[model samples]
Target: NSGYQQQPRQQAPQQFNNQNRIQSMNQFDLIPMSYAELFPALIEKYLVQTRASPPVLAKLPW
Candidate 1:
């Protein structure tokens, strides 16, 4: 009876350590955005910057 009671207490720490190790290993994998997701944001930022700027003198023939 006592062995069974102690079994759960020992297993809990092992399970927690395994989960922590897995999370640490995965943390870096989660930080970066895939190019498909990042490309649209880059395009939108470029468009916004171009729209905010005045037209170039060269673009105007006058």
Candidate 2:
């Protein structure tokens, strides 16, 4: 029980830092886009990636 509670406390800051790092690394990256803004572009990108690469995205733990 104590370990479970500690997990989130540790992960929350790490995830926030990762997001900040990504945004800082690329000012024009898609982290801030809404669904409507992403619809057309995201589909094209997703389709291209699936065709160009193996389906590694499906193997994510999440």
Name the best candidate (by TM-score): 1
- What TM value does model 1 have? 0.25
**Model 2: per-residue lDDT, tens digit, 1-62?**
12211111222232346346522221233344455554578777784243465666756787
Residue pairs in clash, model 1: none
Worst 10 residues of 2 by lDDT: 1-10
lDDT of 1 by residue, 1-62 (tens): 22211111122222346346422221223324555565588788785243467666866565
Off by over 4 Å in 2: 1-30, 47-62
